[model samples]
Target chain A: MKKVYINSIGSISAQKTFENASFLETIADYNDTVLPAIDPVYKDYIPPAAARRMAKGIKMGVVASKIALAEANLENVDAVITGTGMGCVVDSEKFVSAIIDNNEEYLTPTSFIQSTHNTVGGQIALGLGCNGYNFTYVHASISFESALLDAKMQLETEEAENILVGGVDELGAHTVKIHRLINHIKPEAVTSKTVLNSKTSGAVFSEGANFFVLSNLRAAQTYAELLDVKMFNTLEIRTLSKAVLTFLQVNGLFISDVDLIILGNNGDVAYDTYYHELTDKVFAETPQATYKQLSGEFHTASSFGLWMASKIMKSQSVPEAAQLNTIQTSEVNTILLYNQYRGENHSLTLLRHVEV
Target chain B: MSELREELKEKIIEQLNLEDVAVADIADDDSLFGDGLGLDSIDALELIVMLDKDYGIKLSDPKEGRKIFESIGVMADYIAEHRTK
Candidate 1:
């Protein structure tokens, strides 16, 4: 019934993107397998008392939501929807370890209380003092897309005017060890500039939180209009291109209509072929870009992709740090973002430039 | 008994993750819940677990926690009287 626009964006990534004024002007290149999100002064956004018990995931999520809300110039929203693949993994690890270390005798309540998947959403609502609809999706890589879809439905149906949606995941020591054992993380370090073409077997794992304020009511701060979003549990490499074309067509767009394509190519030789299906064939001529090099490969890292798309649309320039190809576009009106994790949970999101 | 009070303050600060607070900040009779130390119900549960784990003092009734955790002085007194370890 109504159109949805990305009114504001906030991101806490491996790169310095928390401040809205600059967009990748100075990229942080790292030669590491696990890129932790750059820290913001958490005390600046949250009081020391409230932040004392929070793990990094919760802090990042809370601060990112606050940035988005402030950018949107709203004190409260009707709903808060968050998508986190490993919800509060640090706290969960702490709670579980305590269970073992103390023989289940002296488990504290703080870690247990904060370990739930919806804790970020609950904390945000709690901080805002807003008793409203809050939901969290933990469907691996498509988690962010799921939250976006839910928020979009409510906004389009006029159920909510403004909604705060975000995706966050924090690195857990044990989880990273397990992933390393399974070869889910890269064997060796790769710099940010070289991660995409290293042709590695596994991704450079990372953690981040990216949030946005989505609203049906457009304002001067609107970044882009959310056109459509599609997700799949499993996609055959052969059918990936067809899915992209179909998604674009459904949104009344064609190959030429898409001004740029943002791909989640995490340099995993085993799975990056999913993005190659479109990049090499269907959308080969389209200006192409990738972000996993800069953001690393977390489940909801696609939220960072959405953040990049919004900034590109608003600023009308694609940062060279994230550019995957030499192709250039004079005007970036429509952007298609495709992302997946280890050949599963594929998501396609369409965003169009909003003239404000 | 004064030694117990100092130990209790250290433990409370460490257990509740009161990073900004020092041992001196928590006066012996200062309130631990509302405006004094600004702890809420969650911190109360942490204190309960701390008492059970370190002092071997298990509190069964939550209402009893209101009086017992009123301050570092009260918590140390309760633990000194009831602690089995």
Candidate 2:
């Protein structure tokens, strides 16, 4: 099997991460129950006529994918895979609301067409004229990992040389309101610095797009080698440690072999114990970092964690803002990311530094 | 007649999400589809909905839309003649 390498990354998160040169140097602190992704100049990446019909999710996904393709120095890829929890949700809401208001009369097709889950992948393919394999995974918390796994398998068997994979979700007004009613969103506003300390029952909901180009051939701009990815439908807290160890062992790694651990701690008091189960016992000595506090929690939020892991592996330093513990590392050669949502859809992704 | 033409221009711009366009940019005789205004099939569907909802004109034959929607003057004249509302 061929080894898969992460050649480049693009992210549009709550922070100003669209510019790849800087690594979380400036943080946008937010004190809100829900955080919206910071917007980029859409015209720069897309034409106005083409962008006119796009929702926020589509714009972010298209721009982020463009950034990744540019960094990989490719005009197009062999495949495009995308994952999203809610696809173009704003348009979905608009279309449904219009139906109710008009009594099922005089409906237009734009909203209905753009609201499909595969629209992002389709739009990216249309923009590049790439007619190769295109797929979208709607699995809840592990959506991004599922997309990554698909890309990894194709690259391993040499079925594809390069693939563009991404995860994206945009906040919708009606969706946010309903989640708040069900206590899935934080009841009170929490600032970035206070997310981990929020001690609340729910997480601060947010939206973002994180994309990466994976290839079998390493290049000068390669970020990290994607070692492995594993997902679980459900994992009990008691067996969490065993699962971690078994995952590492399968990859020919021990707990100590991990140089840094990037965890998905979204400050949901009820479920964060899953992460605590590992940090408290299995990997106490390992340097640790967390990203949901900065990116905010979404179904595909784990994609942001992978992006951070790739960045740390390339820079060999951890930003103080993302540090989960005071422990520092001399070299970040290998990193593991663990993420879950509402105590389910657990995923583990391992990345390693590429030897030039 | 002029009032109806202006309303049609505004409606087309708003309905199609022509964010970069202005009311003055559209001339009465300018083509709505190919080279003049640069709209495509989707915009034709939106305009069909607009004609039904706003002017109470239901187009039974889609081929007729090609001629009626050729320009702003054509659309306004068709709507003025067939509108029941």
Spell out the clash pairs found in candidate 1: none
List model 1 lDDT by residue over A265-343, tens digit each. 9999999888888898888898999998999989999999999999999999999988888899999999999999999
Off by over 4 Å in 1: B1-3
- The C-alpha lDDT values of all candidates are 0.94, 0.94
Q: Please report the TM-score between candidate 1 and the true structure.
A: 0.96
Top candidate (TM-score): 2
lDDT of 2 by residue, A1-356 (tens): 99999999999999998998999998899998899999989899999989999999999999999999999999999999998988889999989998999999999989999989999999999999999999999999999999999999999999999999999999999999999999999899999898888888999999999999999999999999999999999999888899999999999999999999999999999999999998988889999999999999999999899889989999999999999999888989999999999999999999999877
Q: Which stretches of candidate 2 lie over 4 Å from their true place?
A: none
